[model samples]
Target: MFRILFYRPEIPPNTGNTIRLAANTGSQLHLVEPLGFAFEDKHLRRAGLDYHDLAYVRVHPDLDSAWHALLPANVYAFSSHADRCYTDVAYQPGDVLFFGPESAGLPEEIQRLPEITDRLRVPMMPGSRSINLANTTAIALYEAWRQRGFAAGG
Candidate 1:
C-alpha cells in the first residue's frame, strides 16, 4: 500500500480523520514530528470513533528521518501551487503521498527539495478554500487505491 505523510501537521481532527482513512485503506500513516497534538489515540478516537483501532500510524523524528526510513520511493507532494492534477499520476505501492501542515502548506524551500519527485493538486473551483486535510488525503488515497484495484484487501 501507499504511504501517507503528514509533514508537521497541526490539526487534531484532520489527523484523526486521516487515521481512519489509513486504517481502512491499509496505508501506512507517517507523521513527521513535532506534532501539534498528542498521540494518545484518545483524541483521534474521539474524532475517529472505533475506526482509530485500525490505523497503522508511525511517527518520525523529522523529515530527514522519514526520508531515510523510506528511501527511493517516489514522493508526491500535495500543494495548491502545483501544476499537475492528482488524478493524472500513476501511483505505485510504497509511494509516499506527502501533505503539509494545514496552517501553512509545505515551505517553498521544502517544495523545491529534490526528494519530491512530483507535486499534485485536487481540482477545485476558483476562490474556494482548499479542501480539508483529511478529505484531501482520502480523495488522493482512494484515487491511487482505485487505480491499483484496491488489491490489499478482498
Candidate 2:
C-alpha cells in the first residue's frame, strides 16, 4: 500500500474524495494540521460517502510529526514545478506520495527538503495552472498501483 500525505489541505471535498480513493486502493491517508475544514464537515461526508470507515486516515500535528511517523520510506513530492514526471519513478509499496493544499502547492522550502526522494509532476498542456487535488492523486496512485500489476486489487 502507498501512503498519501496532504499538507495543510484547504478543501473538504478534496480530502473526502481522497478518503474514498484511499479506501478503495488500500492506501493510507495522512493529513497535516491547520486543515481548512473539520472532520465532521457535511461536504466531506457527502464526498466520501460511506468510505470514511473503510479508509485509514491519520492526522498529524505538523509536517515534522508526519515525517516522524512516515520516514524510513521513500517520499515523492508532487509539484507542478518539478522537472521529473511522475511515471519516471519505479514506485514501491509503502512509498509516500506527498501533496499540498489545492490553492497553493507545496511550499518551496518543503519541496527542497532532504527527505524527499524526488519531486514529480504530471504533464499537462501549456497554460494549465494545475489539476484538482483528488484527480492528481488518483492519477499518481493508479499509476503506481498499475506498475505493481494492481496487486491485491482483485
Candidate 3:
C-alpha cells in the first residue's frame, strides 16, 4: 500500500476526507504534528463518516518521528514550487506521497531533504493560488494507484 504523509496539516475536514480516501484506497495515512484540530473534532468525524476505524491512521509528534517511522522508502514531496509534474514518475506501492499544511506548502528545508526522491506539482492555471488539500491528495493518490494497475482494488 502507498503511504500518505500530511505534514502539520491545519484543517480538520481535509484530514478527515483523507482518512476516508485512505480507507477506500487501501493506503496508509500518516499525520505529523502539531495539528490544528484535535483528532476528536466533530468536523473531522463528520467528514470521515464511519471510515475512521477502517483507515490505517498514525499520528507522529513531529516530523523527525514521522521520518523515523517511514524511512527507507521513496518520498515525493508535493509543492506548488516544484518543477516536475506529479504524473511523470512511475510510482511504486511503498512510495510516500508527502504533502504539507493547507496554510503553507512544504517548508523549503523539508523539500530540500535528501530523503525526497523528487518534488512534484499538479498542473494549475497561472495565478491560481493552489488546489484544496483533500482534492490534491486524491488526484495524486489516484494517479499513483492507476500507475500501479490499481492492484488489490475491488
Indicate which candidate wins on lDDT.
2
Please tell me which model should have the higher lDDT, number 2 or number 3.
Answer: 2
Cα lDDT of candidate 1 equals: 0.88
How do the residues 29-70 of candidate 1 rate in per-residue lDDT, one tens digit apiece? 899999988877467667777776677888999999999987
The worst-scoring run of ten residues by lDDT in candidate 2 lies at 145-154
Ranking by TM-score: 2, 3, 1
**Off by more than 4 A, model 3:** none
TM-score winner between candidates 1 and 3 = 3
Q: What's the TM-score of every candidate structure?
A: 0.94, 0.98, 0.98
Candidates' C-alpha lDDT: 0.88, 0.95, 0.94
CA-RMSD of model 3: 1.1
- Deviation of model 1 at 114, angstroms: 0.7
Q: How does candidate 1 fare on TM-score?
A: 0.94
lDDT per residue (tens digit) for residues 43-149 in model 3 = 99999999999999999999889999999899999999899999999898888999999999899999999989999999999998899999999999999999988
**lDDT tens per residue, model 2, 5-81:** 99999999999999999999999999999999999999999999999999999999999999999998999999999
